[model samples]
Target: MKTEKFQTILVSASILGLAIMFGCAAFQDAIVPCYISPDALDYADANATTFLPWTTLFDARRIDRFMDFRHLWIQAEDNLQYNFLKGLNAFHIRGSEELKTILFSPTGPIGLAFPALAGGALGTYLFSKPKDKRKIAELEKENKK
Candidate 1:
């Protein structure tokens, strides 16, 4: 909780700093000799590198945190490897966070597919009929006697 508050403060401060810089740049000629080339308030460049990198950094940090181990359990819940033969639902999940982050994230669309693919491959090997001759012979004896 404390960490979340700190992160919020840090993000707010960064955005505040960016707004101040943009406002200053818009009419910087009054304070400085040279005028801005395209003008900061021109909205023509709302995504200007000057103010955008700050937002981008914050966005990336948010995604990176979401993609970390804590949220990994959410993605693992539907995984065949995690559930094994337990059916569709996971037996237990040990993670906590906002659903918006996990559900609305940039990678959310396909995030589930990768784990499902991997787990399906693992389940295929684990649950498939035996390829080994020794195991095949052992199975063949069961119906005979």
Candidate 2:
């Protein structure tokens, strides 16, 4: 019984992990339009107009801009492609005026961990549920009586 339970857990984890990984990959591939908040644009207008490329691999918290860590491919209003490795140099995209819409493409592992972690937790909960055969037997006995 213990071994069966363990096997169930292991299988569940593997299946869930693979499903989450693939599902997230597919979800990322789906093109979704995003709009920049007006406040953010106002801030950008006040500051420098030029901004970093928002890619899937980009971690806003990371201080290092030199690192090639972008996962998504960003196409700015200028119809230019920007990746993590190549910083927007001559092409300037303003947040207020020139800024319109981006052809957001997920080229790398962006927002992948969330689904994987969530799926694993769900799988553990589902597979670890005890199969109460005794309860069923008791129910059957009560029905007969």
- Pick by lDDT: which candidate is best? 1
For residues 1-145, write the lDDT of model 1, one tens digit per residue: 9999999999999999999999977645333322233333232323323333333333333334444644466568757565685543332331233454676565774577777788999998788564676688888899688
Off by over 4 Å in 1: 33-145
lDDT score of model 2?
0.49
The worst-scoring run of ten residues by lDDT in candidate 2 lies at 55-64
What TM-score does prediction 1 earn?
0.22
Candidate 2 per-residue lDDT over residues 18-117, each given as its tens digit:
9999988775523332334445434333221224334222222222231222212222423454353245543453442333333222322334566677
Indicate the TM-score of model 2: 0.22
